[model samples]
Each structure stands twice: as C-alpha cells, then as structure tokens.
Target chain A: MFGEYSLSELASIFAMQGFSGLILFSVFVLMALGLAIIYGQMGVINMAHGEFMILGAYVTYLVSRAFGELPHALFNVYFPVAMVAAFLVAGALGAFVEWALIRRLYRRPLDTLLATWGLSLILQQLYRTIFGAREVGVTMPEWMMGSLKLSDTIEVPINGILVMGIAVAISIAVGVMMHRSSWGRQVRAVVQNRTMAGAVGIDTERTDRLTFAVGCGIAGVAGSAFTMIGSTGPSSGQLYIVDTFLVVVFGGAASLLGTIASAFTISQAQSILEFFLSGSMAKVLTLLTVVGILMLRPQGLFALKLRK
Target chain B: MLKIANLRSGYGASEVLHGLDLELAPGEIVAVMGRNGMGKSTLMKTLMGIIPAMGGEMSVAQTPLNGLKSHKRVAAGVAYVPQGRMIFSALTVQENIETGLTVTGRREAPQDLYSMFPVLWEMRGRRGGNLSGGQQQQLAIARALASDPKTLLLDEPTEGIQPSIIKDMARTLKQLRDARGLSILVSEQVLSFALDVADRIVVIDNGRFVHEAQRADVDAAAVERFLSV
Candidate 1:
C-alpha cells in the first residue's frame, strides 16, 4: 500500500493519521464514558444517548450565537461557559427522563432500548423544528483555529489537541469520582445490590437518577467539544452512535480503563486503514474484526468478576 | 424500639405474612424461628420496607413507618443485614462500610467498628467478594452498625457461617444489646443459636406467630415443633 509513496511521505502520512486517530479516540472516549456509566451501572440501554449529545451541540451553538451580539472580549470565554451550560441543560433533561420514563422501564431492558429509540426520533424531529434542518457550524475562538507544525510535513490541529486534553481530564475526573468518592461507593453498592444498599440507608432511586443525569451531562460536554471538529445538525449525533456503542461494548461495559483502550484501538485501526482503503470499507473491516474478537471472547477486553 | 401490627404482605397474589404482629423493646433481642417458606424473611423485609405492606401499622420509636421508603426506614433508625450477606462484592471492605456512613450522612465509619470486627479491619483493603462467609456476615453487620441505627434486622446471619464464628456472632449480639442498648430482630433457623442470643423467642408458622416465650421459658421441643416441615 505504501510502495507508491516516498519514505518521508509515508512517515508524514502515518503521523497525520495517528493524530486524526487521537481526535477520533477523544470523541469515542467522551461518548462511551457516558454510555458506559448509564448502561454499565444502571443497565439501561439509552438509544437516545446520541440525541443527548446533539442537545449539547445545539446548546453550544445557541451559546455561541447569543455571544455573537455581545462584546468581542466575551467571545473568548464563551466556549467554557457553553460547556457548563451544555452539561447542566443535558443533565437536567436526563434526570427528567429517568424520573418520567427510565425509572418505569428499568426491569425491562429491551423495552428501554425501544422506548429510547423512539425518544431519539422525537428529539431529532424536535431539533429540526426548533433549530431548522440546515447544518450549523460554530465559529471557533482564534486560539483554537491554528495548527502546530511538529515537522516539515507533520502538523497537529490545535483543536484536536484541546479535545484530546479534555477527554483525558474528564476521564481522570470521572475515574476519581467513581472510585474514590463516598457517593461513588453508594452508587457501586446500589449497582451490586439495590435492596441491601437501601437497607443500609442509601437512597437507591435517587442514586439511579443522578447517575443517569451525570452520564447524559458528560455526553453533553462531548457534543460541545465535537463542534470544533464537525458541523452540528438535527441527526449529527446519530452518526457517532454506532461507533460509540462499538467502543463501549468492545470494551468491557463496566470497566473505564477498558473503554479507553478499546476506543484507542478502534479509532487507530479505522484511521490507519482509511489511509489505504475507502472510509466506509475501513469502518466495515474494523467493526468486523471487533465482532470476530468478541465472538471468541464474549466478555470483551476486561471483565470484572462479580459474585452472583 | 420496633413494632408491627396486623401486617400483611406477600409476593404478588400469594400472601406470605398474614396479619402478623410483633414488637421489640429497647436493648432487646427477639429471635424469629420458622420453617422454610414461612414469613420470617417476609416480616423482616416488610419492616425494612423492602417488601411493601399490604395492610399494616408499623413504627420505629413511635414514628409511623407505613408509607416510608426503605432508606427513610433506615433513617428512622432501622438497618438490615439481609440473607446471603448481600455485601457489595466488587467493593473493598472499607468502601462497603463507607456506604453505610454515606447513606446516613456520616463522613466515616465509627472508629470502634474496626476494633469490634478485627477481621474486617485486617482485610479492609480486600474486596468484599474475597472474604469468607463468616467475614462477609461480619462485614454486613458492621455496615449496618455504621448507620448508628436504633433497630437492626438480620435474616439468617449464621446460615453458612462456621461454628466458631457463630459463637462470636452470638457474643457480639449480646454485647450490642447489653452495652449499646440496640434493639435487634433476628430470624434464624438454628434453635440453639437463637436460644443463646435472644432475650425472647417467637415461633412463626404459616405467616403467623404460633408460640412466644421469654428466654428462660423457651422449650426446645416446642420451638422444634414449629421449625420442622
């Protein structure tokens, strides 16, 4: 595949594609982090998880548009404010959904999948009615626009680096919160044994609601970061849903480290393969490989051995 | 500290607890002995609000507990160590204990719980799943105590536990009753273990208390009559 290209050209192509893979990995990690928390902890298959991300993207777009009429100085800080807004708005809606719908369907996982898929269709249509069917793009802050020249042929986009950094920071924060915090202990307890957790005084229902909201909130943040890389539309989130689910399931559902590792592997393989083959073919091959591996080892890369 | 009157509950259409009445005073240990499929667990779960009462009046420390949720029941001073221990197996011993504290709005487990269950302290870093059955039972009890509950509900604590630790468990219950003045309602299949630890014994059959006796008056043959199939 590389015979037609010079040695330096091949090196540069590999470097650029690797960087692209990192960006893809960042998006996958962000999306899968939320899915893993919701599906992994609470056993809810949220098909509308993609809609939640799109909601975040829409929130970011609205925040940028609102800031357009304000002072130029405020434009530089709008992104951070938008990220927070995205998280809060998406999280609040998530809590509402949990209370109104997910709570009733918890004992029925397949029903939740169907219901949330229906919810996704509704949300997508709602977005179209509200924000219009046209694709929207956010104007990036000046600081996020340029690329850094690592060598003569190798240049890394500043926005890609920022997204990767955000993914790393958020992953660590979530890891610490889930493992070290007192609330995390309660969440784990509820996950392990709901009746016992309640018997010991933990508010199991409230924990479920909060966990679902946090997962959606993180998805919102991912959507906000996504605008730096791609355009936002009513169904833009659906584009990544399949890939994100692949990342999460290809990892052990409940393992955070596994999510990151699987995301990296999937993204890198797709990116490198895309360089030699068409994009769709690369994706098909990568997914086929994952499906084959999963067939052999159904538990994925990291399975937690829990008592029945 | 705990009372249930005319309580009725069951799984769906089949009722398990049929108009049961029970009471526990402060610093008292009441052992509920029953055969398999009787209402021993049902009564405990009903009191803890894990199983909703079909018809009943329940209270802890004079507060109405009828409509309260399970956590609210715990907040109203009830804690449960369910059958099978039900510890968070993937969590470390410390984390499992910490859950009790977090639920009750406490920042940490009581300092003395560690000394009381020395094995839990020794294996604080180990996962709950890795502990022996006896150790897991101890951990469950320790977790219940972490909430500083006024009433403790234990269902079959010694079912799979070793004999040596059963003695320790009895001693611990006696100490909790005598020293801390904690009210306890325990369900047990073993007559000897119950006799050793209980201040009062109640025999349940077909979801109703068929016999009751003070600790000194408990007849082994009478209790056995209720326990046998």
Candidate 2:
C-alpha cells in the first residue's frame, strides 16, 4: 500500500490519519471512561450505555434548535450550554435508572446485563418516537465550521480540535475527582468492600447511585462531542458501544490510565489501518490484535494488583 | 455508652444471635467470647449494623440504631473493625483513616490517631495492602477511631496476628479506652486475650450468652471447657 505513495504523501497520510484517530480517541475515552467507572467499580453491566450517549446527542440537538431561535449573538454559546444541559438531563435519567432498576440488581451481574439490555431497547424506541426515525445533525456554530490547514495535504477540522480538547479536559477532571474528592474515596472503598465501607460510614447505596449517575453524565458530554463527527440518530450510540467496551476491557477495566492508553491504541491502529485496508478490515485487525493481547494478559495492560 | 437489647440477627433464614443482650459503659472494654459459629461475630456484626437485626434494639450514645443502615449506624457513633482487618487495599493508610472521618463530614483525619497507632503514621502514605497484619489491625482500629466514635465493635481482632502482636493489640485497646473514653465491644475466641483486655467477659454458645462474669471473676477452667467443643 505504501509503495505507490511518495515520502511526503506518506507523511501527510500518517499525520492526517493520526489527527482523525485523535478525534476517535476522544469519543472512545469519553464513552469508555464512564463504562470503566460503572462496569469496573460497581460490577454493573450497563448494556444501555449507548442509549445514554444517544440521549445526550438528542438533547444536544434539541438545545441547538432552541438556541437557533435566540438572538444572533447568543448562537455562538449554544454548544457549551447544550453540553451542560445534556449532562444534567442524562444524569437525572441515570440517577432514576439506578434507583429504580440498578439498585435491585447489585448482587446479580447477569441480571443487570439482561435488564439494562431491555432498558436500551426501550430508550431507543422512545428516541425514535420522540425525535423521529431519521437521524438529525446539529448545526455547528460558525466558529466550529472551519478547518486549520497545517499543510496543503494536512487539514484538521476546528470541531475535531474542540472534541479532543473536551476529551482531555474531562479526563483530567475525572482523574482529579476520583482521586481527590471525598465521594471518590467512598466510591473506591465501596468497590473494595461494600460491607466494610458501610461500617466506616460511607453510604454504599448513595455512592453506587452517584457513581452510576456520574458515569452516565460523562456519556452525555461524549454525546455533545459526538454531534460534531456523527449525526444524532436513535441508534447512533450502537455504532460506538462495542468499541467503547473494547476500550474498557482492553485497557484493564478498573485502571483509568489503562483505559486512556487502550482507547488511543485502538483508535490509532484502526484509523491507520483503515487508510491501508477496508474499514471493516481495519476494525477486524484491530479487534484481533486486542483479543490476541488479551489472551496473553487476561487481566489487561495495567490491572490493579491485589493479594488473593 | 453502647447498648444492645434482645438482639437477634442471622444469615438469610437461619438466626445466629438469638435474643442476646449486652451493654457497655463509657470507657469500658467488654469481650464476647465464643468458638466458631457460636454467634460471637454475629453479635458484633449486629451491633455494627452490618447484619440486620432479626428483632432487637441497638443504640449508640442513645441514638436508636434499629432501623438504620450500617453507614447511618456509624454516623450515629458506632464503628467496626471486622475480622482480618478489612482495609481498603488500594487506599493509602491516611485515606483509609479518613474513610471514618467522612461520617462526621470531616475532611481532615485526626492527628491523635497517628499518635495512637504510630506505625500507621509512619506508613500513612503506603497502601493498606502493604501493611503487616498487625499494622493493618492497628490501622483498622485507627480508621474506626477517626470518626471519634462513641463505641467501637471489633470482631476477631487477633484472627491473623501473632501472639506477640495480640498482647500489643490488647494494650492498644486499653489505651484507646483510657484516652478516648470510648466503649468497646470485642468478639474473640481466645480466652487469654479476652482476660488480658476485657473488664467484663461473656461467653456465647448456641446463639445465646451462656456465661457472663466480670474479668476478675471469670472461671478459666469452665470457659475453657465451653470452648473445647
């Protein structure tokens, strides 16, 4: 594949592919970060994770339409406002789902998977009924419409930069929140030993609820970012859900740094391979490599070491 | 002060602690001693609200803890150090101690806990999993103390500790009582350790207290016989 291209052309291909891979990395990190917390810490298999992301996308779309009618000066600010609204709306729904559906299934991991799968179906159909069956694209604020030309062959979309920025910011925020915040302490404690965490006065139930909500809230933010690259369809989250889980599992589910590393590796590998091979072939090769690595190191890249 | 009345708790359908009543005066150390499956741990768990009361009442500093969840019971002033010292393996010693402080919504860990368990202070930055068994036990006690709890419940404090450390643990329990004016309820299997630390001793057999006596009046031969089977 490289034989036909000149050295400069190859350089441009690598740079451009790497940049696109970064945008893909942002989406994977945002989605997988939440799944890492939820599936990793709580052991709750949230099959409806994609639906939660889609909810955020639809919410962002609606917010954009609403902001479109506002004064011309306010239009530029709609994206940030929509992002916040997406977080709260999705978080509120997540909180409700946790209390009503998930709290009962804490001990039943398999049941959570089945129940949440049902929840995803319901959420998808609801989105279809409400937002219509067709996919909707949010109108980009004018500032996000342009591309930065690094070279004649290497052009990067402004929105891609914005998406990557959001990913980095949220990742840092999550890292700090999980390490420094009191709730993070509680969450970690609860994950290690729920009964002991309770004895120490950390409300395990409340911790579980908040952890799940925060996970969903992150997916919502990812949804806000998702609008820039993909249209908001009822089933759009389905396209990314498998990749998100792959990132989480391949990274070592409980390790934040591992998740980031895996997301980057997978995204970069897929994009670069896609440039050389068919898109499906790229996905297959990427997955095969991950599976091969997992077979060798089943615990993942940076699994937490605990004595049995 | 800590009080448990007609306490009955069990796993699922099988009752473990059957109508057991106990009380601890402020600054008192009481040991509930029994062999395995005699409900000593059950009594301790029931007191800590880790096990739901089948039928009974528990209170710490006069706050009724019957319907309260385990965490709420801690906030109401009862703390627990379970068997094997259930430390948050991933958390630093300081963070583990701070877990108790969260009950009172206090962000800072108590400085005195470091003094009480000086080893924990020395290894405050180390993860809980790195501590020695004795160090982890002391850390567990220190963690429970961070909330400034009125009462502490310990289940099998000597479970995995060496004989030398067991003596030190007893001494520390006495020190904790003298310093904090906190009542302690410790469940144990070893009579010598109980005799060494407890002001009062009660033997549980078949989910009920079969023998009760002040530490001075405890019959070593009789208690040993009950434990033999």
Candidate 3:
C-alpha cells in the first residue's frame, strides 16, 4: 500500500508528506506558545497548561454539539462562535487559577509547578467526570472532511492544511502582540524587571494576570483546532503536554520565534522517523535528541538577557 | 508639590523610617543625604508606595498617596527612577522607553527621550541589557522623564554611574526643574553632589531625621558625623 510508482509520483509524495509535517509543526507551536508565555516570562511552570488546552478542546466539542442541529449553512457561521467560546472558557479558568492559586505562589516557583500539576490532575478528572472516559472523534463539517489531490500520486487532507494555515496566522498575531504594541512592551517590562516595572507605573499585577489569561486562551485555540484532526477526551491534552513542553523548553522560554523554529525541527524529525521506525520509538528519539541538546546548551536555543 | 508628615515605615519586626517629616516645593531640588541603610531608599519607596508605610501623611498635590498603590501613585504624576538603573534588560531601548507610555495613561510622551539623552536616541534599537551602566542610568532617568511627571523621585541616581554621567544627570535635573517646574526629591550617599544641587538638605541617621538645613546652614562636620556612624 505504501509503494509508489515513479519520480513525479515520489515528488508528490514528498510534497504531501511535507504538508503533513507543516501541520504537525503548527499544532506543537500553538501548544508551546502558551507554555512559553507562562513558563518563560512568569517563571511559573504551569503544568496545568495541557488541561487549559483540553478545556478549549472541550469547549469546541460542546459548541459543535450545540450547533449540530442547526441548518448546514448555519454550521459555517458557528465556527467563530466556537473559537470565541474556547477562548473565554480557557481564559476564565486561567484567571481563576491565577487569582485562587497562582497569586499566592509567586514567591515559590517550584511550589507553583507542583501545585499546577495537581490542578492539572484535578482538571483532568473533572473533564473525565463531565465528558465521560471514552475517546470522542470530532466530526468535521463536510468542507473540512475532504482532501485535495495535487496529482495522481498525492493527496493532502483539507483539514490538516486548514490547521497549518491557522497556526501560522496565530503565531504571527501573537508575535505582533508581544513585540509591537504598548501592552506588549509592558508585558516584556514585567518579565524583565517586575519591581522596576511597578516603579514606573506599568501595572505589573494587571500585566501578570492578563498575560497568563492570553497564554491559556491561545492554548484553548490550539486545542479547539486540534479537534479537527485528533481524538478529544479528558486525557487528550495529556498526550500533547509532554510534546508541548519539550517544544517550549527545547526552543527556549519567552522566545516565540524560538518556539516556532524548534517546533519545525522537532516535528519534522519525528515525522520523518515515524516513517521509518515505530510511532512510539519516533517520539522517544525526538525526546532524546531534545534532552541531549538541552544538556549541551542549558539555556536552550535562545538566551533571554537577565543582566547587562 | 510633594508633602509628608509623621511618616513611619519599616520591614516586618524592624522599623526603618521613624516619623519622617519632609516636603518638596514645586521646582525645588531637595536632597536626603545619608550613609548606606539610613532609610533614604526606604523613604523613597514609602513615598512611591512600594513598601507600606506604618503610619504617615503623604500627598502629591491634593491626592493622598499613603493609601494608594504604587502604580496609582505613578499615575498621580509622581515618577521614581530607582537605584541601580533598573531598565528592562531584554527589551530594546525603544521598547524600554515605551513602558513609560503605559503608565502615563492617555498622555503621549513628550517630543524626544532621544533629545534628553542623545546616546539613547543613537542606540534606540540596541538591547537595554547591552548598554553600559552610564547609558542604563540615562535610560532610567529618561524613562521617568517620558511620563512628564510633576514630581520626580530619584533614589541614589549617582550610584555606580560615571562622573560625566553624574554631572549630566545633575545638570538635567536642574534644567528640568527650571524648565518644567518639576518637583525634585533626590536621595544621595555623596554629600558633594547633593550640596552642589540642593536648595535644602535633610539628613537621616539610623532611620531617624537628625538634621535639617538650607545650603548655607549645612555644616559639613555635622553631616560627616551623622553619616559616619
């Protein structure tokens, strides 16, 4: 079934495979972006990041179900609704976590990590209780379920392409928000020097809460988009959390560009390896590579300057 | 104008500022000179509402500042340029300056931070972490100026800075006070700098105000004795 015919056929196969790689990169990049903001900037390990993403996925699932009875034409309009719902659900949860738990743990980063991990477990169980333990496949709209054939030898699924495009757009939007805007500058200021930022009247407290919320909201968007291609369940986020963290840590914290670059490298490597090796072994290989590189460069691919 | 009466503050268990009474007139360069850990910076922080004051009356204009949050005090037209020139290291010079814009609310930054410190203008794209100490000091002071604050609180502005930059900063403070009628409350460890610029001097020793004098009344021997031990 895997065998191909000729040179043109092989080229098409590579193109199709490259498209799949891009899709993988997009998924991981979005997942890592939130983790990057939380862990990189605030130094909060936020092990609950995956759960936040799962909350978004669950929100997407609920929206899709609610809209299922609507006319076919109306289903298309509900996409925006689903996105907004996912963002609000995840962001609200994030704000709550910051207020109830994170605010108290600012002085103890490690404790925050442990506490967030516990929160992640609690959230997962909460999800399982509400959504049931079964793995649920997201039903794509008719337009999303089809594939486009570039040639006789190659076909690329439309849903994967859509995911790839959305991921790139989100990354660009996030970068602009972090680099170009006044609020973005304030966020960076808080990250760089919290006390100094306060001294200058930057409202560091507000910045902290908003930054965490934005991070979780983006994670929700990632999770919602993931429903297009993957299984959704309480534990669905756990499957990606390790990979997400690997991408962020291997990329470097607070470095969005680093996240994108590392996502490309890691996803492509894993995709190529899975083609030759077993799927589980491919992941192990990628993880090992990340570990080795991190050992050599303790600061990862980018080093945020801490002092002059 | 800035005013304080019966200001009392301290860290947990130990009091650092005891019933501190002081005031800064609009457009006046007043200095609080002391040795290390003499509650100079603490007084500055208390005025800015960073560290909670145990008890006191503090005000910027008619707005009471003792109960206000640090950021609110900033918005009330009080600016603080802290010691060690704490500019955001990872931010580019322009981005660091932009932080001042956030605190200023709807008000736009005046013409050019670049004009105030031409070197910062020349290296606007460079990371603040890469700038020299003198440049960072300039950036810190320039950042405060960006808000067009009515009162500027500078804590040890000359610490770890080059002599040329020190003179430039002193000159800039005078010029700003003269031009904008900016109220200045500067904390300093060096007597010479304070003597050169201050209209009045207040001395704090071991967390208590020990002496108050106008420039001519400031006895050098008394200052040295208060600062020594």
- Global lDDT scores for all candidate models: 0.92, 0.91, 0.85
- Regions of candidate 2 where Cα sits further than 4 Å from its true position: none
Off by over 4 Å in 1: A306-308
lDDT of 1: 0.92
Cα lDDT of candidate 3 equals 0.85
The CAPRI class of candidate 1 is medium
> What's the TM for chain B in candidate 2?
0.97
Q: List clash counts for every candidate, in order.
A: 0, 0, 0
Model 2 DockQ class: medium
Q: Which stretches of candidate 3 lie over 4 Å from their true place?
A: A1-17, A304-307
What is the DockQ of the complex in model 2? Answer: 0.80
Which one wins on DockQ?
Answer: 2
DockQ of all candidate complexes: 0.74, 0.80, 0.70
Per-prediction RMSD in angstroms?
A: 1.2, 1.2, 2.4
lDDT tens readout by residue for model 2, B74-151: 888898999889999999998899898887888998778888788888898998988888899999998898887899
Where is the poorest 10-residue window by lDDT in model 3 chain B? B103-112
